[model samples]
Target: MRILLIEDDDLIVESLTKALTEQHYVVDVATDGETGWELAEAFVYNLILLDVVLPKLDGFSLCQRLRSQGNQTPILLLTAQDTSTSKVTGLDAGADDYLAKPFDMSEWLARMRALLRRGGASLPPLLEWRNLQLDPSTCEVTCNGQPLHLPPKEYELLELLG
Candidate 1:
């Protein structure tokens, strides 16, 4: 899975990146909301981890903009703001989930998995185009019963095409 992490805090970014990478997730980091938005526009990610307070643009605005543009990528807002109003605003702005600061990594990972599983509402458990078969949950592809070795980008492209 690929994740776009938009956070300005270097320490948090480093820790999260390390943990996610160790779990075999491809992570891209953006220090500011503008850069994050640009990257999000240019690439297709399974999930976006956005911090509420951001430079150039706040997470709420970014989430709203992405939704306005019809970007359906699951967005998980990470913020220090832990109030009911803030959580409501984030969800109202189109965030799929929210995680407060100082959150446990396991909880974050669990939420991410849930979002990813629920994100592709129309996607089937198995995709087949001619002899090509793809099982997204396992990241396994096969052609005529033979396993196909695909790099991450290729796999993503195939999934998109499928």
Candidate 2:
């Protein structure tokens, strides 16, 4: 999964980036909302972890602008505010999910996975081509119920051919 992390706190950014990377996710960090919005517009991401308080532009406005441009990427807002109004505003501004500060990393990861699973955010874990099946997570390939001795590139090529 590819994630765009928009945060001004360096510690939070570093920690989340390292932790998410360890889980096999490609993470890009933007220190401010303007950069975050630009990057989000420029590339396709599996999820956007947006911080409400940011420099130049706020997360809420950025999300709204993104939605206005017809970008359907999932936005997960991370904020210190836990009020109902804040939640409502965030949701209204086009955030798909909201997580308050002092959150558990496990819960964040779980939520991210859930959001990705609910839509066309990331690639499927498995790919089937003709009579062959490839499991990307396990790096295993099978053809016609028989195991195939295939190199990684060769397997990918065959899968692409189909």
Candidate 3:
């Protein structure tokens, strides 16, 4: 699984990267919201672990921006903002879940599993690039209306690259 972690705290980033990697998740880190936004747009992630307080852009604004642009990826907000208003704002801004700082790792992992099980957001049925079309549901690839059969390794590579 791939996860994007957008956080600025060095200690938190180091700890989470170690923990998530131990679980076999490929994690991409972005310390600021602008970089996070760019990374989110350039690649697909199974989940995004976002800190509510960030440089360049706040998590609430970033979350709202992502939702406004139709990004369906599951977002879990992590922050020190533990108030009811913060939780509500996070959810209302399109975060799938919220976790305050000082949370239990086991609980956090459970939340991650639950959100991933839900499959979060979905991409369009057909993904297009130039004349090439890929159907994720059928695992089929075509170019310029012609079938393009490829080996599984190549197919998986192309899927990831696309």
The C-alpha stretches of model 3 lying farther than 4 A from their native spots are: 120-162
Q: For model 3, give the RMSD to the true fold.
A: 8.1
For candidate 3, lDDT tens digit of each residue in 1-162?
678999999999999998876555668999999999999999998889999999999999999999999998899999999999999999999999999998999999889878876883453357789998876534578999999887655766666767
| Rank list by lDDT | 1, 3, 2
TM-score per model over all chains = 0.78, 0.78, 0.75
Count of backbone collisions in candidate 1: 0
- Lowest-lDDT window of 10 residues in candidate 1? 116-125
Question: What shift in Å separates residue 148 of candidate 2 from its native position after superposition?
Answer: 17
Give the per-residue lDDT digits (tens) of candidate 1, residues 123-144.
Answer: 3479888888998755789999
Candidate 2: segments with Cα more than 4 A from true spot? 121-162
Off by over 4 Å in 1: 121-162
Clashes of 2: 0
Candidate with more favorable, higher lDDT: 2 or 3: 3
Candidate 2: residue 61 Cα off by (Å): 0.5
